[model samples]
Target: MNVLKPLSGSTLALLACMAAGALCGLVAEPAGALAYLFGQLYLAVVNMAAMPLLVVATFFGLRQVCELPRPAWRVGTIGALALGLMVLCGVAGTLAGALAMPGAHLPEHAYATFGERLLQSAGDAQEVGVTLFDGADAAVSQTSAYGWREAVPDNFYRVLAQGHPLGILAGTLLFGLAFAALSREQTSMLGNVFEGVYRTLEIIIERANLLIPVLAFGTAAWVSAHTPPAMLAAMGSFLVCFLACAAVLGGAATALTARRAGLPLVQIVASLKAPLLVGLTSGSATASIPHTIEAMSARLGFSRGIVELIVPFGAVFVRAGSALYFSLATVFVANLYDRPLGAGDFAVIAFASVGAAFLSSGKSGVATVGYMGVVLSLLQLPAEAASVLFVTIDLICEGPRNVVSLLAVCAVIALVSAGLPSERVMPEPLRAQPQVRAPLRFALSRGQLALVAGCAMTVASLIVLMGIGVGAK
Candidate 1:
């Protein structure tokens, strides 16, 4: 067997391809068109896998969560904390983006460029709204990001093929829950098959990233050959907001860990230093897991089993980093298209972001950014066109994203291991919802848990539909 397993990524190959791409863009303008085609080929291949992976990953990941050997109360605590933390992170991002207006107030040229791309995503209507400022036609196209037809799938395969991220996400959630409900004995064989499939997709995508040079070159040449320079600044502004949000979350996580562990803030920071660095450099939470476990259990003195359980769970299931990124990024797109956001819009941004982050698990780099399609679709934003610019800056953003992921796990472990009791938070017959203040409280039964979950999901779905309906108008 081959030793070392090829280092598990194509980082060097990516660099080489990028060099070749840059060279082509600079020295061979005539051949630039050919390079662009190859890049398009790469994008198409990735998109083909992106949607399928969204489904398979969701199904498989949820099954694994369900299969945890822990008791029902433990599982419910994890679920509640993860969901609450993720929503908290997303809402924070939405606030930051709303106040900062990263995609708003762009310079004249950059504004027009994004506006055109927004209009372009409306395909058939693009002809009428050649410019974003084309009066009523442009106004109509901008508000058309959501509809009844798009939210509900008639045929799942067709919807997946059409690049409908929200539709795929909705379908996958229902399917994943049903699959997760099957006993391990019943799903043993199929589980192995999907596990293999998910791993294979990861490998394929990693290898495909090696050809990112092609995509990079094409994107760079296309931008340089056509657009003005101000677009770069627009992207930078968004990144600044993204990093700001990550920073805010990261600092809060550090504080929470210090308080929960009853350790000094300096000590907590020092203990977390290694994993934070790994996350910052690799931009992969999996890469940082070893360091995170060591920091939490070995250095910080949390229970080893709990540390192990919560770290990986936080890395994959929590996904607050992606949640934060999505909230800001989605709102950024809305502002780019000059779509106004009301209170309902912010609610949609926060809710859609958490859902999108769940599907975004196990993806990195281009694939991670590409999966923004889900949230964008929910908001009826132009995922296809907006992703073009977003992907160009995605690499620069990953470091902060990963760093936040590590910090989030630290905070989660602190909360789960010491901050709260390991009891279920079932729906009570109380007048007001007591679960809000102390989520995942002690002493709930299985039947009550199910009833509470059903009620929560029902209320959430109604809110989403209403928010979507309001935004689309």
Candidate 2:
């Protein structure tokens, strides 16, 4: 009877799917798997739509800001430091968690019935030094659970969920940038077409998001219904590691931003209160943009121009929170499945986290899975399983991720401010003018396309090499 049928139908279907999965949990282990698979498909559909939406919004925003003259050396230096901080925090936290592996074990079975499932899962063998699971203290030896492979359909779902197809996110980003370029300068006919595409994407993204409550409720209900407390306990150490890494990343960015801003750390923390509140409430950075920029400009004395330009850009590139989340999430999944992380895997994770951050537009919801999907695909992880955790646990840690991202933006603005001599600081009003121009002609020229194509091909070759390595395992 609901008048809005598509919306109502999608919601009902998602809920029913989740309910069925949860009910299955009571039946048997296969039920749990079935429930998990259902959750995975729901997540996959949500995530597949996410990458293009986020990539387009982000690249378009970046292209719009790309023309602003900056002391690139200064901004780059700070940006690099911020990036390094994320990578370092990730590595260090992972190392600490790894070292702690010897003592980790699942909570007692009484806590949740899933402990048996968790333990059965832990039977798979891993390398000598690697700690296979976060909670388990026992080192996995070469045992019966060898040469394990995921169920096929689920495996494919994960591949796409991991989103690492060579140019998938990148291509979308390029298209977004191209779309934005053409949008501003083109005549009505071509412009109208591009606008239509953008509008269509916008509508689709909006509709997809309407399913969040359904997804969230179903995911939560299903988790509560199906997964025993022990499964939750089994996941404790992994969650702890992730939160710890996110904290380090967020904490470090906050400290750095406060220090670099030439203000008290408390003031820096206070400065973020507005944006943090917005980010937490809305769960989207793009939505929080006006508040974040307003707060920065009014309270923090950041010029509106810099705040607007830098914050938006920071949402994409300076995502310390999301970067750390993405990296740690991958590690957690690998750990969950008893997959070993090699040096090459580590490098891929680090670079990919940065790239994913760059590609993500600050729409605060679960679109992160899209980028995560891309990474999982590239790294060849079981992304479907990863998406299961993200949907269920988004509220658990998104706060820290958003805070870290905000701090990173503040830091960039601060760093930019520091490098500008007083004279070069444009008046606040002038800063908002059309300071950057889109070189549409040049951007669409044959040369740029060829260059991008070449880079794409090179990256593809490297990915193939990486795939071969993954295959060997």
Among all candidates shown, the one with the greatest lDDT:
1
| Full-model lDDT for every candidate | 0.67, 0.53
- State the local distance difference test value for candidate 2: 0.53
On residues 354-434, what C-alpha lDDT tens digit does candidate 2 reach at each position?
A: 656545543345666656654565666655445655654565566567776776677666666544444134433445677
Q: After superposition, how far is residue 303 of candidate 2 from its true place, in Å?
A: 2.8
Models 1 onward score TM values of 0.54, 0.50
Worst 10 residues of 2 by lDDT: 138-147
Q: Which digits, one per residue and each the tens of the lDDT, describe model 1 over residues 1-473?
A: 12212322234544454466556666676576677777667656655664565567667555654554563565577668778888999999999988999888777877676666555545644443332222433433333333335556777887777766656666776787798899989989998898787667656655554454455555555445443355557677788888878988899989998998777899888777656654653445554555566577667776555564566556555678888998899989899878899999899889878877776665566777866766676666777677767865675677688787778777767776664333212112222435466467578799999999999999999999999999999
At residue 218, candidate 1 shows an lDDT of 59
Q: Give Cα distance to truth, residue 165, candidate 2, Å.
A: 19
In model 1, which regions exceed 4 Å deviation?
1-71, 112-230, 419-473
